[model samples]
Target: MVGVMRSCLRSLLKLMNSIIGMVGTGMILYSLWMIRLWHQHLDGGGSISQIPWFIYTFLGLGISLCLITCSGHIAAETANGHCLSCYMVFVFLVVLLEAAVTADVFLNRNWEEDFPEDPTGRFEEFKKFVRSNFEMCKWIGSLIVAAQALSILLAMILRALGPDRGGYYDSDDDYTPARLPLLKPPVQQPPYAVDSHFKLKNDVWNTNR
Candidate 1:
């Protein structure tokens, strides 16, 4: 019954990892889109008035998350303890990075401060237009962070309650209580020797009678 439950848990964690992997891939694409837009709209006259570094950072986080998802699924399927441990650690870092990015994106929403040179009064218009997009991206980061946190939890749990392992080939042939060992057949006495001994004893008993 415990094995059955562990199997079910492995299935569920793999499914979640696959779904979150897709989400992480989408986030990477979104970060690329953000970079493109920042260049096309915010960069002008040899001055790039945008936060591209943060977007790049977010992209790295997304890639790490994707790797964790894929590796975690493989580890769960194989019941690999070391692989699972590494996955959990990397995912925890991803969660932290994503949470920081989300907080920075949502809290620091002052578009005018980011691009302070607005002579034609387009900053207000830009703010109104870009705020929604910013929020969307921020929510994406937040969601991924949440998912990664859950992935960490799942990985940790799997490390504890995963499955039976440690089976390996044995060279010796001693029986132990820890596990059943292969046994060899005992040596047999010759049938002729046994019959002669029994006949000699019978003749001695008959002569005495």
Candidate 2:
């Protein structure tokens, strides 16, 4: 029963990591697309000299998340606790960082109003550009943040309450006897000790190991 539970737990963890991987990859691809869109906006005489910091932030976050999730997935497959410990620490830090960034994107007024007004209806074009590029990223970033938080929670639970058994489970067939070296007298040493000086004098039995 314990083994069955452990198997289920591992499967669940893998599923969660797979979700993380997918989301992270999606964010990365979207960021790249948004970057291209921003470049186009720049070429069209848009006065937003700076792209939103959140674009680069999302890229960094997505890469880190994908790598960390992959590492955690592989580590969870092992019985070693150290890997899980390290992974948990990373997950905790990332969760904090992601939450903070997500909050900043909304709460900070500077980002939304950074662009300058153009007199020849360019402002309207830029507004559409911002809405299209920023809105998708904003929503996706929010989702990714929530998903990362969820990942952290699930990872913590898995780390704390692992397999139903205390440790790894193994069958009787997996057990093997330990091999110990057997000590024997050196082959070159004769069974009886001989006195070289007095050729006839010799010990009854040799004691050298």
Candidate 3:
């Protein structure tokens, strides 16, 4: 039972590590993609204002940094056998920072002055679309942060429970209760050599003879 529990805990830890690593790698890749896309847009005669460029650049850098931090945490956990709580906290911080940066980017967009050439036509339509999309992005960012926070909280709880509660890795010296022995079936005996009265009947017949 102890061995099984330990195996389960190890598997859980590995799964968590893999998930965080993938998320971090994805973040870095997405940031690079966004930067590349923006550059392409600029090259294609799209008049991207300096403000949006700055916002994109800032967000890209922030996401890159967060990914780096997450990677570092994962490496540290792998190398040092540290508690998963540390990684959880790191992830939580990264999520919170991401949320803040996203909010800032959306808020800093100047819809009123954007595309002034077409006063109530193209610019208004574009502004409405941007506003709606930005709001959606903001909600998405919030949900991501919320999910990260929940994961961190759960990791902390599992860490607190230790290996005894089927959490965390246990060392060889860890105390585990001995498993109870399995019950064995009762042994069957051959049928009695004869009925109880057989010996008495035999003795009476011998005396009569």
TM-score, every prediction? 0.57, 0.55, 0.40
lDDT string, candidate 1, 78-163, tens digits: 76778889888777766666567556756897633653354333345545766768888567646656666666777777778755
For residue 162, give model 2's deviation from the true position in Å: 6.3
The window of 10 residues in a row where model 2 has the poorest summed lDDT is 200-209
* Predicted model with the maximum lDDT: 1
lDDT to native, each model: 0.68, 0.66, 0.54
* Candidate 1 weakest ten by summed lDDT: 166-175
| Model 3, span 9-41: residue lDDT tens | 445545554554555566566556656766677
lDDT of 2 by residue, 30-79 (tens): 77886787778779887774446666766887898799888878766862
The residue-level lDDT of candidate 1 at 151 comes to 68
| Candidate that beats the other on lDDT, 1 or 2, i.e. the better one | 1
The local lDDT score (0 to 100) that residue 152 gets in candidate 3 is 61
Overall local distance difference test of candidate 2: 0.66
lDDT of 1 at 113: 60
